[model samples]
Target: MVDPAPAQTKLANEQVELNIPIQPLGAAISRYGNATGRDVLYDANLASGRLSSEVRGVFAPDEALNKLLVGTGLKAELITGKTFVLVPVPASQQARQTSSPEHLRYYGLIQAGITDALCDAQGAHPGRYRFTAKLWIAPDGAVVRSRRIGSTGTPRSDHEIDAALRRVQLNKAPPPGFQQPVIILIVPQGPGVTRGCDRP
Candidate 1:
């Protein structure tokens, strides 16, 4: 006699499984405070299934989220058709599921490296040079966009910066799951070198 089909087999072709990193809302706020060297307090309200992190600063939500989950294996999901932070099904429940193509997190290492090189080549003056670079990243850290911000540098310097950034590629996954447009500020330390956003 023929055996009956399993229930999992029926749903295997109809669902998707995603693994996302989650941060304690409170810890995230505190970390952001420490990173920016700001002694500010943040408030988190998770009333309607949404987590709102409010801190006094100029950081975008995605930026803040990235900072919050630093070092955590978790990743954010920013797909247009899906909601954020959804719950994952139990492993037992997924036995028959046809898993979706895995997701990826793209980073901007090469672009960052080139920017550092340009900064080194440009020597630091007595003042600051605030420039912005547009980064193009893939789902798992493959840089797709590497253009200079429109108003972040001098006409001559901007061109140079653009050229420098073109050499960068997303060589690794960013944090995880989330991919969106990001603008970064590059401050020069000396000719062909620079540092992260801290010390002048």
Candidate 2:
């Protein structure tokens, strides 16, 4: 039997009719979400002083969302089948974070661990979808707590991700003064992309 498409994928491909006009970013997002039956989440401050791009016509929910975000210095990230969060672009985010070698090493370790955990599950692989999360790791390298920003488009996959993360223990502790609630962003791979699930 063929497996059904994941909820995230289905949501992205589903077309919706939208007639949102150029307006405040916050208001536009609201209208888009209401029209598409999806939830859009973002900090109010981020929407302040920003205007949305005009969007009209039938288009995939993702496409409409992208249109609304144009020139707004923000991007819509699907966290679940019906939820999205607006976050600053990667370029802007990178400018605010530490990029030292030590930090990079720790970041790699964290990502590798997360990848392994997600890959172990049938529908929770990283490269196939996109999501964001906040992780609180203890000094001893254990993921003491985790807060997922969105869904994997399915409750089963979301559960798998949460279960996997609860057991994650990095190889080493983070460097001194490392930040808490490490942000993790996983973006979908492009066409013809494939990734093996070899433990890191």
Candidate 3:
């Protein structure tokens, strides 16, 4: 079994500017990035103010984005005229790591296969879905398990993404010397769209 998703690293600042796609209406619509690209987040689609396409990785549903802006009076609507664009959210503390050489060895072994599964899974999705797949590795880098730390896509797609991740395998020994667990956060090749999918 995989370890649970790592908690967001305690942030030093309350709000950070995520590389989100905003419409000319000044409404954020999507987010991207994950471990596959070493969780590199990017900004896309914007001209002066109005948005160019439907945001792809805001994580939350359109209604949620609307709710978030309710107090602010800004509307969150999907743009139908343009193609959808994927963007990555801001990087968080939990997304990064500082490991020793031994840990690096295990990280390499586990991440190689894990990422491969991600590539295969992302390719299957119609929308470019990107998000962080957080993994727990031993001090030597052996993978314990993985979870979507962040995401952008449909709810069913998130489930599909989770299913795809479950197919990954880590059948190797961890690096020498370390016995503690290690964590690896992965970002898929596509954009993530899994925000505000909360339960009451």
Q: Which candidate comes out best when scored by lDDT?
A: 2
Q: Residue by residue across 75-155, what tens digits does model 2's lDDT show?
A: 878787767788877774544444767877888888888877777766677776767877766545767677677876888
Single out the weakest 10-residue window by summed lDDT for candidate 1: 1-10
Question: Which ten residues in a row are the worst by lDDT in model 2?
Answer: 1-10
Selected candidate, larger lDDT, 2 vs 3: 2
Q: What is the TM-score of each candidate against the true structure?
A: 0.35, 0.48, 0.35
Off by over 4 Å in 3: 1-98, 122-127, 137-144, 176-181, 188-200
Off by over 4 Å in 2: 1-97, 191-200
Candidate 3 structure quality by residue, lDDT tens digits, 1-200: 11112224322222223333323322333221110111111132321222222223323232233322221212323343212222222234113322566556666766666555655664334234456665433222234345775656567767767776677666764433232223455443344522221221
Model 1, 51: alpha-carbon shift in Å?
25
Error of 3 at 113 (Å): 1.5
lDDT of 1 by residue, 1-200 (tens): 11112122212123222123233444443344333322322223321222222233445444554444332223345443211341223344333221223321122444445545554544432125666666544444555556665544467656655665665655665543332334566654567764543333
Identify the leading candidate in terms of TM-score: 2
Clashes of 1: 26
Residue-level lDDT for 142 in candidate 2: 67
